[model samples]
Target chain A: MSITFKLDVLKPHQPNSPTLARALKQIEGVKYVNIRVEEIDQKTTSIIIFIRGNEGLLLDKIVEVLDGNNCALHSVDEVTIQDD
Target chain B: MSITFKLDVLKPHQPNSPTLARALKQIEGVKYVNIRVEEIDQKTTSIIIFIRGNEGLLLDKIVEVLDGNNCALHSVDEVTIQDD
Candidate 1:
């Protein structure tokens, strides 16, 4: 069975770094790792990552990757264009 | 007012293409463009592009850009891990 997870990340200072990519694939549950560059301010390339994986394991791996990379993930905002 | 638009794209075969990057910035309503490399399959590097722009104009420009780039975006899934 396959499942998808929303994983948005910010790469403000490192857009071409493959280090994060390598670490993400090391996780056990991650099936796909999609990266989207969302915002750039001053010197940051904010990005979003979409992944497919087992829920618990994916979250665990996220934590591990964040720790290893010394980066932090953002809380997803459930902002739907609700009334139109 | 400022807003964020989720624009996920698949760059199946070209991860280093800067043309898309350049084209995206030309849209009038676009506030920012972020890219994330989500998956790598054989000869493709699937990526996501997150953007912020005026609702109507953004959609219009997206269509124009897609027409120019020959890419299609997928319907965003409202797949929440509903019950956990």
Candidate 2:
């Protein structure tokens, strides 16, 4: 089974800064990561990360990675898996 | 691939009034619906809906359901599929 989460990340000191991409990749059990950047409050950039992992282990891995990163849990929603 | 969206609802006049839920189910092409509610700003409710459907048809169905509900698009994330 798979679970998906939407991450609202603080603006990277630099756009495309690898801090998030790298941190997420380091989280054990995260099978895939797709990050999109958005700006809210005009000053803070929100990094939206899409992730998939073992249903039993995904949230712990995600929370670990998000610790101390100024990240917020926007939402977590389950989805149908696409083979693509 | 499946796509999922997070919605920020502007607090229904009544919680669990079923307007949002029924409106969502009315949208064609939504295969599965799971809605979780959150409250922010002490008044507004944020709805997190999880759905499964044709990979190509999910978003349009969701958007149509969300139309004119004082809703805001929070984020859309993807995930791996689980047969369960």
Candidate 3:
């Protein structure tokens, strides 16, 4: 199955969107990742992330990566799954 | 060049998201399109549309199709262009 996720995340400035995107893309089944900044504050940046991947995508793993980058997973806004 | 656009749009329920996506895909040079509904009111649905295409994509044509389907283009949130 193919899965698509829309997530709300808050991150520190260091890794940045491109760096985060690259990290997400390196995951096992991820095909595409897009991160759009929604808000920027002194300490953190809020982003809307869209990820397209296969069933191998694990929410826990995604959260792990975000945690490693000093980011917070605000919410999993939407999830769509399609069978192959 | 490859272009990616994030747009805010409002549309009536008739055509639906999948239908609108199909219509947009038919436009010349379009490669990918994704529409996520953000809000739904009594009369309209607000959506965030992400479109990835080549340089041939014309904003006017996109607007024309949306107009024909009784949709309104609220705002263009972001635009990214990458040179090949």
Model 3, range A1-84, lDDT digits (tens) per residue?
988889999988777565576677677787777778787788888888887788989888899988988999999999999998
For model 2, what is the alpha-carbon lDDT of residue A1? Answer: 42
**Residues B1-84, model 1: lDDT tens digits:** 233445555564642646776678678866677767787778656667766554334354665785577656652211111111
Candidate 1 B-chain TM-score: 0.67
The list of candidate 3 runs beyond 4 A from truth reads B1-84
Per-residue CA lDDT of model 1 for A1-84, tens digit only, reads: 545656555554542323454456457755445455566567655656555555445465675676567556775432121121
Provide DockQ values for all models, in the order shown.
0.04, 0.07, 0.04
By DockQ, the better pick of 1 and 2 is 2
Query: For model 3, how big is the CA root-mean-square deviation?
Result: 9.9
User: Candidate 2 at B34: error in angstroms?
Assistant: 5.2
Question: After superposition on all CA atoms, what RMSD does each candidate show versus the true structure?
Answer: 15.4, 10.5, 9.9
Q: Alpha-carbon interface RMSD of model 3?
A: 7.2
Report the number of the highest-DockQ candidate.
Answer: 2
Off by over 4 Å in 2: A14-17, A40-43, A58-60, A70-84, B1-84
Give all candidates' CA lDDT scores. Answer: 0.54, 0.53, 0.81
Interface RMSDs of all predictions? 10.7, 8.4, 7.2
Q: lDDT tens string, model 3, B1-84?
A: 566778889999889999999998888899999999999999899999988888667667888988988899875555554445
Pairwise TM-score winner, candidates 2 and 3: 3
